[model samples]
Target: MSDDGRIATDGIAERECGEPQREPPCEFCHIAAGDEPAARLYADEQTVAFLDRQPAVTGHTLIVPRAHEGELFHLDAAATAAVFETVQTMTDALEAALEPDGFSVFYTSGPLVGTVEHAHVHLVPRFEDDSVSLALSRRRLGESDASELVSAIREYC
Candidate 1:
């Protein structure tokens, strides 16, 4: 580990503050572990926030738990709360700095919907006419279909 508490993984050199010297198996884990570089915004014992490289908007950011949790379901309650707390702080900062019309906070839990396996909450700043849509087209469910879906969900709950 370097003076900044970042580990030099493989042959990747330790950086003072720029981009990561090497890519790790889990990008978010690497960033949180201080093994990879990111445009870090906030960090605590349990979580970290950083800018999204392929941002949906100017202030697009990701808040994640420092631990390597592949899905939101994998996080303990404290870890989940830590991640959201960072999300709240970053959202406020984004609003103050960018003056966006609105903002969005979302998470994808599984491989089917999530790009990264690491549990993360996306904080996307929105503006009028931004041409971004988080909307999914609505489809009416038949009574039987709705009942079946509800039953399936309730089983897990």
Candidate 2:
């Protein structure tokens, strides 16, 4: 990858993205061949879970194996273990980070959902009032009940 966060450019640069600086997905396998964008949460090269750009709810994170997969358990036991381990860590963090009433975790595979064409787990946070609440590190929790949960959230963050 280039210092600019893209694969080193060749003459293949095109105006399809409406800006010369915007590289098309077709030009890179990571976005096209690999079937999706890079992750927001990455540890070494084992796995990543990033907030979905088109989220069902704010703080909705997508967890997946670093290796592109069409099925969940297609991964070797060790690799599968790694992805799930990160999923647990992320779940605890999201609960505290978003302070939602509760949260849910699910995954879709095969050609049916075809989510970005890769098998990925969805970490959707459920709130009591059904309003959008982001798990922003910048904002402090409000209300005594919510504030009390912050410590618990911090434990996992």
Candidate 3:
């Protein structure tokens, strides 16, 4: 409700990108819709896949659901299924084109992730030098909490 979007924070930024609450205005939609310039990798009537401008690698791509749901889990069942298909297709394209050591497909949601208002999947190619593959430090998380959380997750599922 203020300049800082989070009421309480641990150094998260208030995005001044001027996007609307539940949906970004049509510029990105247009870019996603083939009306603007983007390194489009794959597209169809219901989805679009394109390279990230601030890419982790040459073929780092994002596949966005055409309907705006704002988060991955918020997507309807069919949309979720479609996003997985798109991710697989895009990842394969990136591998064949750029040939990285491996690939990581990420779906970032919630308040701290998916900075945009639309649902999207990032197809980030993992190379040996990528800073993203850094190990999680045990010091940052308590052993008990980690074990309990993993147990809770398994139980819930």
Per-residue lDDT for 1-157 in model 2, tens only? 5444444466233334433333333212253223456446545367767777788877888776766556778888987888788888888888777788777777766777664545577888897777655543776657996977987899998
Q: Order of all candidates by lDDT, from best down to worst?
A: 1, 3, 2
Error of 1 at 10 (Å): 17
Identify the candidate with maximal TM-score: 1
TM-score of predicted model 2? 0.57
lDDT of 2 at 12: 32
Off by over 4 Å in 1: 1-24
Q: How accurate locally, in lDDT, is each candidate?
A: 0.84, 0.65, 0.73
**Candidate 3 regions with alpha-carbon error over 4 angstroms:** 1-27, 138-157
Superior by TM-score: candidate 1 or candidate 2: 1
Alpha-carbon shift of residue 114 in model 1 (angstroms): 3.1
Q: 1-157, model 1: which lDDT tens digit per residue?
A: 7656666877454566744544346788788888789999989999999999999889899998887777865788988888888888998899899999989889976778888877889999999978779998899889999999999999999
Task: Give the least accurate 10-residue stretch of model 3, judged by summed lDDT.
Answer: 6-15
Per-residue lDDT of candidate 3, residues 60-147 (tens digit): 7888887767677787888788888888888777788888999877777777855676778878888887777635466577899999
Stronger candidate by lDDT (1 vs 3): 1
